[model samples]
Target: MKASAFVLLLISGLPAAAIAQPNTAQGELLRRGELTGSRPSAKAQMQAASRPANHASDPAQQHLLQTDINLAQARAEELPNLYERFMATTRDERRTWTAPQWDAAGEVLARLNQRYEQVRTDLPLDDRLRVRSLQGEFHTLRGARNVKEKLE
Candidate 1:
């Protein structure tokens, strides 16, 4: 009976020893910057290595980034015009908007929403908030238009 109890205690302690052994291997891997299962793919690792530590000194990359920013800004500037057209047509009192008019407005709103989402990360916090507010307005207008059509 004493031998059996000793064997049981030894078996239970083996798992604790196994758990402790992992710290040595994991610590060495951590020191070497080589993660096991979660290591980055070879392509991503190569890209990361090739990138300069100080990116601001890379003129070509800087130019490309600036060009992208300029294009995004240009696209963002068009939002106001699109929003104005949507409001003008939807708010006009001379006649109820037909299906085609609603379709056009929806298309414009979709475009505006897409552009905002694409460049929202680059926008200032205030601009991001404003874009969200504008999106909400677009959704409200769409709902109101739907209700009007249902009533008609």
Candidate 2:
């Protein structure tokens, strides 16, 4: 019954409501807001008008990928080292990271994941396993941190 939980519940039900009650006014609104296939709905303009603009004044918001190293350029051989470095900072310096900072870290993690996808076969078995392990740990820590933050 928490406000956040209630909001989450309402948001989750929107797609179902859109399909289940297409004729209802609420469902009509939801359908208008949804993206249809590769194209947006005809009411996309109206939905866009109702949406608020983003606030990107924070440094973290401006620069989402803030890994110390050039993660985007890291090769397959360096995947383990780069992942280890980022994970270490996430555990240490990033312990106090706000949502925006974590967002940047997530971007870096995603970049690493993309690189891994491209060069996974070229990487040694140990390196591949290490990269995957780091990826899993990153998600686990992020989720745990989110829970901890919510509880606090």
Candidate 3:
């Protein structure tokens, strides 16, 4: 048993070492171009993005776009429909999303919740219930994706 465990550890360490080395595509710390500096900070990125003078809407330019989930047109009467649309669009796309994409989705979901709060009093009882159910469905999709990735 000891010999077998040693062989297994040896086999595993090779791949782990290879993966640990920094590559061009991904790593904990990526250099900035050929300057040997670290990756641009969030503030640096925002400054770079807002640098274009021809673009008058600086706020619009600064907003991060990750997924296609849009709830801007949602109202009290249309909250359920909007939530359903969000669920449908995100169901398959979340599986392939990276960490940044997931963060963006979470930001959008928080915004949706804010909208719900603004119009909750105006929403009918059944529609409100449906909206809650749709939110639950979105969470379920996230849970399943996590489980699938863990299994893989």
The lowest-lDDT stretch of 10 consecutive residues in candidate 2 is 27-36
| Model 2: per-residue Cα lDDT over 1-152, one tens digit each | 69999999999999997676323122122222121122335574455346333322434323433334454355678777777876777787557788867776774554455445556667888887787777778778888989999999
Cα-based TM-score, every candidate? 0.42, 0.54, 0.49
Best-first order by lDDT: 2, 3, 1
Error of 3 at 57 (Å): 9.5
Writing each residue's lDDT as its tens digit, candidate 3 over 64-136 gives 2223333443557866666666566677577687756655555444445545655666888898788777766
* Local distance difference test, each candidate: 0.45, 0.58, 0.53
Q: Compared with the true structure, what per-residue lDDT tens digits does model 1 show for residues 19-75?
A: 654332221121111222233455544543453333333333223223222222346
Best by lDDT: 2
Whose lDDT is higher: candidate 1's or candidate 2's? 2
Q: Which residue ranges in model 2 land beyond 4 Å of their true spot?
A: 1-72
Clashes of 1: 0
Where does candidate 3 clash, by residue pair? none
What is candidate 2's CA lDDT for residue 94? 56
